[model samples]
Target: MTTDADDVRSFDQRGGAAQPKALSAIRTIARREIAEQLSSARFLIIALLVVGLTPLAVYVGARDYKSRLEDYNRLVAEQQKMIAGPAGREVKGFDVGWSEGNDLAVLRAIRPPEPVSALVRGLDGALPQYWDFSPTGIVTGPLASRPQRIADVVGHLDMAFLMRVALGLLAILLAFDAVAGEKELGTLRAVLSQPISRAALLTGKLAGGAVTLLLPLAAAFLIALISAQLFGVDLIAAGALAKVVMLALTAGAYLVCFYALGLFVSSLVSSQKTSLVVLLVVWVVAVLAVPPIATMVAQAASPVPTSQYLETRKDALDLDIRRQAELEMGGVYREITGDPEGNADTDKYYKNKESIDRRIVPIEVGYLNRRRQILNEIDRDAERRAANQNRFASLLMAISPAAAFAGAATDLAGTGDAQYAAWLESVRRYQDSLNAALFDDPPTVMIRNRGASFPAELRKPPTVADLPSFAPPRRDAAAVLSRSLPAIGLLGLFTGVFIIGGFFAFSRYDVR
Candidate 1:
C-alpha cells in the first residue's frame, strides 16, 4: 500500500530528490520521534525526577560556596594585616624564621573555591584550601574535603551529578527502545518499507531524541544559572561565563554519547526488553563500577601519603629544624670559643658576656644555612611524591569519561590542578621575593654594624610593605581551554565514533 512516507521516499529516490528532500525526510522522522517521546510517560517521569533532585544539589553547593568565599576573604585580610605589620607587631617572644615555626612571613598559597562550584563543584572542594609558604617550607594542609556520608563520597547533586548520573541514564532509557522497540511492534518495518533511507531514519530519530532530551535540560540549566546569581556566586572572574558554557557543552556531549550508545545497542538487539537490560548493565559499569575501580587502581599503583601522615611528617620536620637550628647555633658558639656547653646556661654564658656576644652573629648565620639546606631537601622530596601521585590518578581516569569530564570541568571552573599550580607558583614567587628582602636586610647585622649587641630590635619591625604583594594567578578562558583542549577533543572524537557506529549499525539492521 502506498503511504505518505512512501510517496515522499519515491519523490526523493527519483529525479525529484535532492539534499533538501533528504533533510526533509530526516526532519519528518525527527519531528515524529520528538512528539512521541514528549508524549510518553517515561519522558514525564524522568523530567520530573531531574527537576526534583537538581535543587537539593544547588542549595548545598550554594551554601558551601558562600562559606568558602567568606573564609577566603577573611584569610586574605588577616594575611594583609600581618604583612602590614599591624597584626604581628607584638608577637610574643623573639622572632624566628618561618622554618623554625616563626609566623613572620605572611606569604600563603591559596586556591580559593570557585564560585560556580555551587553548580558544578569538583575535586577542588576536596583539595587543600591554603598552605603556608616559607623559604625553607613545610606545607601542611588538607588534600581534599571530607564528605559526611556515602552520597557525598559517591556523588553530589551538582551539574556533574546530573551529567554523570541522571542525564546519562536518561539518555539510555530514551534510546534503548528507539529502534528495537519499534521493530518489535512492526513500526520499524513499516517505516522502512517507505522510500526513506535507513540511515536517514536513524539520524532523524537520534537527532529528534537528542533535541527532546536537551529541551528539558536547557530549561533546567537556565534555572540553575539564574539560581547561581541569586546564590551570590562570584561571576566576574575572567572567562567565568566561558567556563560555564564549556562545562555545559561537555555535559551535552556526554549525554548525547550515551544516547547514541543506546541506539547502537538497540540496533544490534532484536527485543526492546533485551536492549534495555543490556544498556542498563552497560550504564552501571560505565558510570559506576569503572570510576571507583580506576581510583583504587590508581591508589595501588601510586601510593600517596595520607593527610594525617603529611601533617605529622611536617611537624616532625619542623621539630628537626628547631633542633638543628639550636645545635648549629651552639656548635658555632663552641667552635668559636672552645665551649661545648655554649649558651646552655644563660647566667654562666653571661660570665663571659663579651665572648658569647662576639660569636652570636656568626653562629646565627651558620645555623640558618644548615636549617635551609635540610628543609629544602625535605620539601623537594614531598613535592615530587605528591606530583607523582597526582599524575598517576590522572592517567587511570583516562578510560572513564565521567572522570575525564569532571577533571576537565573542574579545571575550567578554576578549581582543579591548574588553579593549584597557579596558587603554588604565585606563593613561590612571593616567597622568593620575601627571602630576598629578608636576606638583604639582616636586622641584627644592621644593629651589630652600629655597634649594638646580639638580638637587637629591628629599626622598622620588618614591615612587609617593602615586599611585593602576591596576586594569586587566575587562568583565563584561553589558558583553561588550552589545558583541557586535548581531553575535550578526545571526548568529541569518541562521541563521533559512537554516532558513526550507530549509523552503520542501523543501516545493516534487519527490518524483517
Candidate 2:
C-alpha cells in the first residue's frame, strides 16, 4: 500500500513539473469537443442523409438533360426538312422563272459548299469551308443545326441548382450548432477555466470543426465525379473537378463565417436557445428572404420581362414582314431613280423602274436589320441591368451567413447569373455573324411587272453557307477565381473577428 502511494506521488510530481502548455490545453479541449460531436447521433444522421440523397439528385438531373438533348436533335431534323423543300429554291420569297440560259447562269452563281450540314449544326464556329449540292442543283442553306440540347440542360442543373441549394444547405447545417451548442451544455465553464488564451482556443476549435465538416464534403465531390461519368458527360480536363473543389472550399468558408457568427451570438446571449433562434432568423433573412427580394427588385428596376413576352413580340414582327418588303421596294425605287412622283410612260418607265428597284434591294434589307437590332438591344440592356442588381445584392448580403452560402454556392456550381451572361455573349457573336452575311452584300431583287418573259435583270439568292454560326461562351476560370476572392476574404475576416471576440468574452466569463 505504501509503495502504491509512493508511485502515485511520483507521477503527480512529474505531472506538476511539466504543466500543460497553453496550446496543448486548447488542443485538448478542441479534441474533446470533436469527439463529443462525432459520438452524437446528429452527426451520423446528417452524414447518412447527404450521402443518400446526393446520388438521386444527380441521377435525375442527368436523365432529364439527356432526354432534352434527344428531343432537340429531332427538332433540328424537322426544321431541316422544312427549310429544304420548295422554299429552299426561292430567294427571299421570289419565285424563280429562269430561261434556259438564265437557269444555267443562276445555278452556276451559287453552289452549295461541300458538307454544308456541319456548318449548320453549329459544330463549326462559322460556315463550313465546303458544301454538298442536291441532284436538282438548287443552292440551299446549311441544314438547321444547334449544339446538342443536353449541353444546355446539364449546364443549368449541374452547376446552378446542385451547387447553390445542396452544398449551401449542407454548410449551414454543419455550422449552426458549432459554437452555440457548447454554451448549451454545462461544460463551457470548464473549457474557459483553462489557462489557454482565448485566441488559441478559438483557433483550435475552428480547425477541429473544419476537419469534421470536410470529410462529407470530400465524399460529395466523389459522388459528383461518378455522376458526371454515369451521365456520359465529356469529363474533359480537370475543369469539373476543380469546380467541385472550389465549390466545397467556398461552402466551407461560408460555414466558418457562420460558425463565428454563432459564437458571437452565443457570447452575447447567456442562453443557447436564444442564440439558436437568432441563428435561424439570420438564415431565413439571408437565404430565403434576400435572394428573391433581390430578383424582384432587379426585375422591377430593369423591367426585363419573361421569355414569353420576347416570343410574342417576335411573332408580331414576323407577321409584318410582307408590309416591310413593300415599303423597302418602294423606298429603293424612289431613291435609285430620284423620282418621288409617278411617271406617265408606263411601258418604258415600268421596265426601267424594275431594274432600279433591284439595285436598291439592300435598302429594304437594312430596314429589316435595324428593327431587329433595336429589339435585341432592349433585351440585352434590361438583362444586363438586372444582373447588376443581383450582383449588388450578393455584395450587400456578404455580411449575413445565409447570403454568404448562396453566393458561394452559385460561384461553385458555375450556374449563377454568370451563365446567362455567357449566353448573351454568344448571342452577340451570332449577331455579328448575321451582319457579316446579310448586310455586307445585300441581295438585289428583279421585279417582273409585265406578264411576259423573265425580267431583264437577274438576281441571286443568299446561300445558307453564308449565314452566321453561334458559338457558346465559356467562363474564364481566372475570372471566376477573382470574383470569389471578395466573398472569401470577407468571410475570413468576419470569422477571425468573431473568434477573437469570443475568446475575450469567455476569458472574462465568470465560472462560479
Candidate 3:
C-alpha cells in the first residue's frame, strides 16, 4: 500500500549522514589547502632556500667525515711506529721485568688502541659503523665503520632546521588566517549557515592545513637523500631509512601539533597579529632560549674540573713517603721469612724497603681512589643538575610544540644530553677495565739500569703492543629506545590531545 513518493522519501532520509560523503570533497579541500600556500611568494622563497641549502650542508658534512677518517688512519700508523721504535724500550728491576722507579707500568697497563678502529669508512669501510668520541654513545671493540655523517646531515636538514623553524613558520602562517581571515572576507557566516555539522567543517579545514604544511618536509627529505648520495655518503641502511621515515612522520605530527596550538591561541585571541606575536614569543622561549640556558645552569651547578687540577691535587697528597717506615719493616720480614724481631740483623735494609713500599702503595691507592671518588661526585652532581633541566625542558615541551619537536628529533638523532651522558658512562666502564689490568699484579714495576752484562732488551718494561686496549661496555639499542619512550610518549600524547582539541574547537567555532 506504500506509494512511490514514500519510498523515495525514505531513501532521502537515509542519505542524511552528518559528514562529507565523497572522497572527492576531502581531496578538494586538501588541494585548496596546499594551493593556498603554493601561491604565496614568501613560502615559495623559503622552500627554495631549504631545498638548496640541504645538499650543500650534506656535502660539507661528508667532507668533514672523510678528513676525520684520514686523521684516524694517520694516528694508527704513528702508534705502530712508536711501538716498533727505540723509545719503546723495556723496563727492569720489577718482578715482571718492569722498573720500580718508572710509571711505565701504568703506561703499559692501559695502552690505547689504534685510532683506525674509531674511524668511519677509513680505507673503505662497511655498514653499521660505530663512531668514536661520541659523548652520547659509541660501539666498543672492532666493528664496521660506516660514515654517520649522512645521519648527521639528514638529521640536520630534516629535523633541526625544518621541524623547528620551517614547519613551525608554516603552521603560524596557515593559522594566522584560520578564523580571522574568513571573518574578514565576510564568508564566515555563509560557511556556518550550511546544513553541514560544525565539527565536519573544522575537520576539513585542519586536514587541509596539515597537508599544506607537511608537503615541504616530504620534498626536503627526498631532495636530501638524493643530495647525500652525491656526496659519497650512502645512508641507505635499513635502519637509517627507517629512521628517516619516522622523522618525516614525526615532522608531520609536529606540524599538526603546532598548527593546532596556534589555532587554539588564535581562536581565543581577538586579533590575528596578536596571535602570531604570541606564537613567535612561545617559539623563541621554548626552542631558541631554553636548552642552552639549561645546559649552562647544569654546568654551573656541577662544574667539570680540568684533568691537570685533579693530577696536581693527587700529587700534592703523597701518602707514599709518609708510610715508608712501616713498609720497610714489612719488607725485611718478607725477605728474612720471619717476624720483624727475628730479622732484626737485616732490619736496616728490610726497614728501608718496607718504608718505600708502604709510602708508595698507600699513596698510589689513595691517589687513584680519591681521584675516582672526586670524578664520581662531579658526575653525580652533573646528573642531578641535568635532572632539573630535564624537568624544565619537559614542561616546555608541554607548552610549546616546537620544544616537543626538538626533543623528539634530537632523541632520534641520539644527540641529546641524556644520550651524551650514557656515552660518558661507557667510557668510564672502559677506564675501570683499564684499572683492573693495571692492578692485576704487584701492579707496580720498577725500572732500573741494565745489569753490567745484560743486554739493553733486559733493561726495559714490556712492549706497549703487549698490553690490551680498553673496551667500553656494550649498549643495547633496544634499551636506548626504551629509555626514550617517555619523551616519545609525551610528544605523542601532546599530538593526540591537540588533534582532538583542534577538531572540537573548529567544529564549535562561531564563524560568524
lDDT winner among the candidates?
1
lDDT of each: 0.69, 0.50, 0.52
Candidate 1, residues 1-512, lDDT tens digits: the string is 89999999899789683544768989999999899989888788887777666666777788888877777787778777675665254321123432233545365555577777888776667666676544344354554445547766667778777767877888888999999999999999888877888888989988898898887677666666777777776454546777877777777887787888889999988999999999999888778887787777777887777757755775686577657656765665576546766443444445655655555545454444444556656565666776787777667766666666667677776666756666666766665665566533344431121122234333354545454556777567777777777567667776787788888888888889
Off by over 4 Å in 1: 1-20, 86-105, 141-151, 234-238, 308-325, 334-340, 344-376, 429-465
Model 2 RMSD vs true structure = 9.8
Give the per-residue lDDT digits (tens) of candidate 2, residues 112-161. Answer: 11111110111121221112111111222332223446754343333323
Question: Can you give the lDDT of residue 135 in candidate 2?
Answer: 15
Ranked candidates (lDDT, high to low):
1, 3, 2
Query: Each model's TM-score, in the order given?
Result: 0.82, 0.67, 0.66
Score candidate 3 by TM-score against the native: 0.66
Query: Measured by TM-score, how close is model 1 to the native structure?
Result: 0.82
* Candidate 1 Cα deviation (angstroms), residue 156: 2.0
What C-alpha RMSD separates each model from the true structure? 5.3, 9.8, 9.0
Which segments of model 2 are wrong by more than 4 Å?
A: 1-23, 68-185, 234-237, 300-302, 306-360, 392-400, 433-438, 443-471, 475-512
Candidate 2 collision pairs? 113-130, 113-131, 113-132, 114-130, 114-131, 115-131, 141-464
Residue lDDT tens for model 3, 337-454: 4554423333333444554344434443443345445544544555565567666646544555566666665545444444545545655564455444433232342211112111
